[model samples]
Target chain A: MKLRKSEDSENEVELNMTPMIDVVFLLIIFFMVVSELSTLNLEEIELPLADESEVLKSEKLDARHIICNVREDGTIRIQGNSYKKEQLADYLKVEADAEEREPANPSNPAVPPSKLYLTIRAHKDTKFENVQNVFDACSQNGIYKTRVMATKDE
Target chain B: MIARLLRRRPRSRSSRPKAVEEAKLELTPMIDCVFLLLIFFMCNLEFVKQDGLIKAFLPKDRGQSTGPSVTDLGEVRVKLLWCAPGTTIETEDRDVGEVVLKIEKNVYPRSGATPDWEMLYLDLVKMRDIRDRSGNPDALPVIIDARPLVPHAAVVGALNACVKARIKDVTFAAPERPF
Candidate 1:
């Protein structure tokens, strides 16, 4: 094979397409993974508006909390996976059982409570009965620490 | 010799620039496609909503109440219910509001007039002050009880009111429903 050399040796540079394409593909993959991971625990639900709400504090949002999502149709979801009402009860029971229960407060307690917290994200249009079901399930499991999610337009 | 050189055309030398052009890859199309993808991903990315949290306390009736719930406590109960039909109420969000906001004994009926949640919040603050004067300020647990048909927005609205009132002890009433 005869190599064709450019007579004026300025080295006619050939831009490599392989590495560029590789980087582009890697970027696409990165975005895909990041978007999926970011939205794993959250659902696309319209939160109710709150007149006055405190800004979320990072210390309050620790890794030990469970994010429970309730859709308008009363479907319960955890980590993007949908669960039935009975299944949710069973799930909470397991979580509650896993946590070490603290001594019951004499001032207001009938039983010892678990320290596990549950954050409920319910759609604004959802029926109160749906939220009640979740609240009841958490309470029955001894997970009394709970918070409801809302958004402020301002 | 001059005649022979002239007859031999300088084709390769004349088209050397064309050969160089062919040797280099055309990056414009690929770059265009890459930019399009970047724009697509950037536009597709959704920022999570700034959701605020309202803490809630749920009661567990395991057996019996121990000591009148945190010693002597002045409890405030807020009940929300769906309004009667034909009572057209529109909230600020343009949602047709039907939630009746009741704080203590004063009732803000959802009967045609818009129920002011802000007013209910103020009443809770006043009641909380009254309880504070009696010594158990932190023990004034505001229970928010809503009917089944009431929307979650209504419940959150009440919860928001309680939180804004700085009532530390807030509970959501999940009373046993009569089937």
Candidate 2:
């Protein structure tokens, strides 16, 4: 009689943990995948500072625009090479053509538009003529959206 | 009659109650989850934020001419005028100690004709050096009066030199020309 009672008590103490552990492991995998897709390029470039002014909101991605760095000593660097104001229009025209052919999605037959957005970084002491040349090139190339890079005032 | 003989008799004492199982917390898995979230936020934060260091002084409205006098008493004004190959810089309205011309040079040995950027840089440096030694560094604001025909790249070059010299205040005075 005593042996039969002990066996019945042991059978009633069973616990189920499969469902709880399944939820925890699912959350871990989700976060791991999201972290991988949010990486961005963090390069060091000097941006001109502006006075107290309202911020201009823009949605253009960095890859879609041409970045030009104008040094204080009248040196125009486009993608790391020195260029004169007169040479900018021709160079940009070639770049715009190349961008049109290299579609972001190769599977799609439709090509992306070759609209160029220019981001200019000028130093405080730079001559007005040097900065003006860049603006002229953009207009000549049919690129209307020109943004001057400025640091936020704190 | 045989089954009854094999069965045991019940005890006269009362039976004891069954006890419940104790619940305990597991912290190892929870700790791992917390660490993963911490790493995610750290990587996404932008550390080196760029902000504007220079302040621009806009020209006062012509209607409000009584606001303040526009003078070079405590500021350094650089007026840039465009000239043709043989045209003199003094023909413009502004006065300066000297005027430098930026002409294209041939730098490519193979092509025999390439634009040289070194001369432009040298001229800018000399201009900045002259401005720095002129007066009190903190009191003087650098004013750039650009000609309409000047190239945009030249203006950027001049601005870059001011930044290199750590001049925080700059302004643009546009010429009276129909755009």
Candidate 3:
């Protein structure tokens, strides 16, 4: 049998890898940035679902905000450190004092709210008392602004 | 000139094409390695989590007695109490108020056992519409005064209702225990 002649067999094709490498490097950078933003000091807990809950935005995410993870056992967890009910109050006062104090209330000039942004992340099944204690602690420390984290309802 | 444009001629008729002069590159290995790295990073990457929050600013009177004793109760106060099934507000187990919206004040069922979250939502919506007609939609600030032991879900439900009603401000109350 006679062999068939192939024209492409003699030509050497070189793919330019510059663009591919550039694209790859760009993808790597994108992932790195996203991972850095996701590395927040937060504890994982089951949050309740709410249809009208406000979605977390970049503006709402401040660098100095504290997250309190309350469990069914009534212990508050902050960045993996657990604080008892009694201890939470003291810890919160210290944290509140560290942040800038809010401007004095227009109605009540004597008691200014704390500038501390407190986010309460509690298990859905956890009793409200535990969360209330956190609020009470916040109130004692003059922190009035709070947001309870929840899952967005479909 | 036409032949040169249509087809490039070999320098020598008996020799190989001019392109064969450069060394051949083994692209398969490089492509495979690149894909492997991409897969590794893709597998390792974590997706950003999406969460919602129920916004609240506690009343100035919550934890301290030193604040002004003037109690600024909400015009529309939604109280969530903890009660058992088929039990009246008086008979509710105080240890854990499992999120019943109606007790004695919001007595819808008359039996007073079941909490009415929907009623709370409807009432707040009605309040919003009335305020809107009066041209002060944002004038009403709602206070969700949930008992200490009520389930957190119940409070969220109440807050969600107020938010849906487009209430301007929603606050929680730390009322003195009224046993």
Candidate 4:
């Protein structure tokens, strides 16, 4: 049998692109806005107010600094990523290793604990044992410079 | 002459089609990819952490006792006590069943037997002033002795009270009884 000529070949199809470009621009804007909203890598928890809490400034918002979050349900999250409680120390170790290297001072050599800073963001309602476990993990992994985050009381 | 113009019209339409096609950037595929990316981001977005950092020392490792002497109560020893769920009486000031804070044997809200952070802050301020009046150049360290079962909020509440009083030297004491 002879092949039949295509029926739609007589008409030239032109695809409209304005809507596509408009949608793409919108998507790019949406992603950019949401990404900026997530600068801190943790979940929002009701923090206990300390009338005397000091406002601390993080050195760099990058990987050199790490955040460990303990939710009210005792779930542990590291840098917005979930981790089993048993694996907390290993995660901190990996993050510490990934930290940027610093030049060792000749007079006062920096120790492993001094290299990276660890921050614990525990929920106000979370059990003290949960926070202590994470703190123990920090101690075990040689993470000495640790900060417990809280909100200033009104 | 008429035949020549007609021939040029067909040629122009065919040849100029390439320019028209090039002007239309075929952004549908790119838009599709962006939509996929947007969906990925939306599905993965988690809650943002809004709490601020309060510089606190980690607990002393097990069996390592480098803490100050027990006689240094004047140095601001804020003890946090956790009550059983049913034993805690509901107070107008604090939520029911919250941990209590004690400074120098004086419990917050001496009358209600509930957590009163404001009163705790005043005491810490006095302790800080006493330390400063003693002519100590170094910042005075405040010991936070919290029970293992106490909620972190109570510990943080005590710490915040100290920090709000400008007592920055904060340290956590090992739980008297391990969990």
The numbered model that scores best in TM-score is 1
Q: Which stretches of candidate 4 lie over 4 Å from their true place?
A: A1-40, A50-58, A61-63, A97-112, A151-154, B1-50, B59-74, B84-97, B107-114, B176-179
Off by over 4 Å in 3: A1-40, A58-63, A106-111, B1-45, B60-63, B66-74, B90-98, B109-116, B131-138, B175-179
Docking class of 3: acceptable
Off by over 4 Å in 2: A1-48, A52-63, A99-114, B1-45, B50-145, B148-179
lDDT of each residue in B1-179, candidate 2, tens digit only? 22223222333212533463333455456547655665554554533354332223232222112334454455555444454333433334222212333322322122101112344335445655676788556533566655644444334445545555555555554334343
Candidate 3 chain A: worst-modelled 10 consecutive residues by lDDT: A1-10
Please give me the DockQ of candidate 3 compared with the native complex: 0.35
Tell me how far the alpha carbon of residue A55 in candidate 1 is from the true structure, in angstroms, after superposition.
Answer: 3.6
Q: Kindly indicate the candidate among 1 and 3 with the higher lDDT.
A: 1
lDDT of 3 at B174: 65
Error of 1 at A125 (Å): 1.7
Ranking by DockQ: 1, 3, 4, 2
Which residue pairs in candidate 3 have backbone atoms (N, alpha carbon, C) closer than 3 angstroms, thus clashing? B82-B97
Off by over 4 Å in 1: A1-10, A60-62, A98-112, B1-25, B42-46, B59-73, B86-97, B109-114
Per-model DockQ against the true two-chain complex: 0.40, 0.06, 0.35, 0.32
Q: Write the residue-wise lDDT of candidate 3 on A11-75 in tens digits.
A: 53745565676687677777666555444345556677788877767654564788788876666
Ranking according to lDDT, highest score first = 1, 3, 4, 2
Cα-based TM-score, every candidate: 0.76, 0.35, 0.67, 0.64
